[model samples]
Structure formats: structure tokens, C-alpha cells
Target: MSDVIRASAAPKPVGTYPHARRVGDLLFLSGIGPRDPATNAIPGNEYFADGRVRSYDITTQTQAVFANVRAVLEASGACWEDLVDVTVYLTDMARDFKAYNAVWAEYFPDIDTAPCRTTLGITALPTPIAIELKCTAVVRADNRQD
Candidate 1:
């Protein structure tokens, strides 16, 4: 059986989709951003209502994005260790890759436990956020420690 997972602690998806979908032992997550669930605010984003880009910090946004992804994983009865793969979308590759990689290493300290990852530089995202992460996780019965 398959199930859709919505995490109350994470920001609602920008489109009409659930945070994640589960089939068998795997959970596929939608692209997650750095928006705060309670305030709908994007951390480290400086795009104003006037459509001008100000200052965007990749490190700050990366931290928030990871937190949002964690909330979804937890809601789906999984954890960081269960993550098997991830695809990262970055608006500015030349400017942001170093900062993003630094934050990512903090989460996946060991190279052996780190998920396989692909990062793509895009022209833009649905929102003004600098980065978005889409991940797949292995959800074992014992991973539901919650």
C-alpha cells in the first residue's frame, strides 16, 4: 500500500502535492525549501516584493532547508540515516555551492553514510529561495522510533 505524508511541522508545499509519498519501504519527498512553516517566510532570501534580488545567503538557507526536510522525514517515520539519495537544485552554482556543501557536510558527517546526491544549477525556482532539496529514503519498520 502507498501513503501520502504531510508534515505539520514543515512548510506546506507550494503546489498541490503532499510532502512525501510512501510505497513499501521507501519514501519519496517533494522538493523542500527553506520557508518557515509557521510564518511562510524564506530564511536568507532577500528578494523583495518589487522583484529585486538583494542578498541571499546559501548557508542560512541550507540549514533551514535541512530542517524542513527533517520534519518531513520524521513525520513519515524515518530519519536522516534513512536517506538514500538526494537531488539539490541551486539557482546560483558558482556562488552557492561551497556554502551549501559546508552545511550538507554537517548533516552527513561520514562519507559512508551520506546519501548519493546530484546537484543542478537552475535559472530559477518556483519561489525566491536559493535552493530546494528532493530526497528519497529507506523506511524500515524499525525506523519509526517516533
Candidate 2:
């Protein structure tokens, strides 16, 4: 059976979607952004008068996005080590890649055990955040038919 999952600890999804869905042994996460869960504020971000983003700290966004993904995994009875794949989106690759990658290194630490990852540059996200993550993990061991 498949189960839809929502994480109260993660930022609420901007649109109509659950945080993740469990299909048998796999947990598929939605695009997780860096919005603060309680305040809904974008960290390390400055806005223009019209609410457009003026400046953002990619390092902060990257760190928060990873935390958001972790929250979803934990909510779905999974763990960080259970991650098998990740897709990263960045608004500006050339400017942000180094900082983002550095924070990623801190989180993963070991290349051999890290999840397989692919990163892409995109024009924009729905919000003013600079980074977002979509992930898939092996939740088979905790497969208790949620």
C-alpha cells in the first residue's frame, strides 16, 4: 500500500502536495525548499519592495534545504543514510555551486556512503529561495504498512 506523508517539522509545501509518499519500500519526497517551518520566512534573504528577492545567501538556503529534506525523511520513518538519490535545483549555478557544495560536504562528509545526486540550474523557484531538493530513500526496513 502507498501512504502519503506530511511533516509538521518541515516547511509547508507551497502548493497542494504532501511532503512525501511511501510506495512499498521507497519514500519519494517532494521539492523541499528552505522556508522556515514556523515563521515561513526565507533565511538569509533580502527582498525588494515588490516582494521580489534582491539578495540571498545560497549557503544558508542549501543548509536549510537539506534540513527540510531530513525532516521529511524522519517523518516517513526513514533516516538520512536511507537516502538513495537526490535531485538539486539552483537558480544560479555559477555563483552558488561552490558554497552549496561545501555545505553538502559537511552534511555527507563521506563520498562513498553519500546518496547519488544530480544538480540542475533552473531559472527560478516558486518562492524566493535559491535552492530546493527532491529526494528518494529506501524505507524498506521500516516498512510497517503506513
Candidate 3:
């Protein structure tokens, strides 16, 4: 059975899925949006407060998505250092690529240990969120539950 782990710092999933899942040495994270837990807001997706959905800007949304990813990794007793792979899906790939890479570089400052990654342009996402990030990481040795 897989052990489900939820990151306290990340916004709660709006659907039926854990923030992450630990199976043996690996953790698989679900696609995450730029939702803020404190505000219960998704800036560029469906707006909760105004009841008006807004389109996402590349930079802000990308950073927030990565932040959510980091929160999940930390909550799962792992970190970017443990990440082995990442998959990014975007609605506007050509225009958003630069902004996405900039924030991505900030997150993985050590380019030498970069995880394998796949970035693709999709026609649409669940919401208007510009970007979604999902990852795979190794459970750190000291924090291994099993």
C-alpha cells in the first residue's frame, strides 16, 4: 500500500488526492496549482473571492507552482535535492517558457544535480492556471518511513 502524505504548507487539494504518495523509496506528487493556502485563492485559475476566473501571468504563476511543489517535497520528508524527475505542463508553452525557466533556476540553484524533467505545451488544464508541476523524488534516507 502507498503511504499518503500531505504538505501542511501547501494549499489543500480541491479534489480527491493526497499532496504526495510514498511507495518504497519514491514519492510521486500530484500536479499542483498556484493556490495560496492562507487566502484559499488561486490567482489565475477560478477566482474564489470574486467568483471571476482570471488568466494567469507566466512569472507569478510559475513561482507559486514551484513553491507548492517545494512544500509538498518538504512535507514528504524530502527536498529538491531528493527530486529525481519533474513533469511540467503548460497551456502557453512558447511564451511562458522563459519565465518558467527563470523561476525553475531559482529553485534548483545547483544545476549540476538537476532532476530529469519534461516540459510540454498542452491545450488546456483543469482550470485556467497557466502551469502545473508534478514530481518524483526519493524519500531521504533519514526520513524514510519504511
> Against the true structure, whose lDDT is highest?
1
After superposition, candidate 1 runs with Cα above 4 Å error: 47-51, 144-146
Stretches > 4 Å off in candidate 3: 44-55
| lDDT tens digits by residue: candidate 2, 1-146 | 88999999999999999999999888999999999999999999998999877899999888888888999998999999999999999999999999999999999999999999999999999988889999999996644445
Where does candidate 3 clash, by residue pair? none
Encode model 1's per-residue lDDT on 12-57: one tens digit a residue. 9999999999998999999999999999988886766896778888
**Model 2 shows how many backbone clashes?**
0
Question: Whole-model Cα lDDT per candidate?
Answer: 0.93, 0.92, 0.84
> Which scores greater on lDDT, model 2 or model 3?
2
Per-residue lDDT for 57 in model 3? Answer: 71
- Model 3 lDDT per residue over 55-97, tens place: 5577888878888888998888888689899999988888889
Comparison by lDDT, 1 against 2, better one: 1
Give the TM-score of each candidate.
Answer: 0.94, 0.94, 0.86
Clashing pairs in 1: none
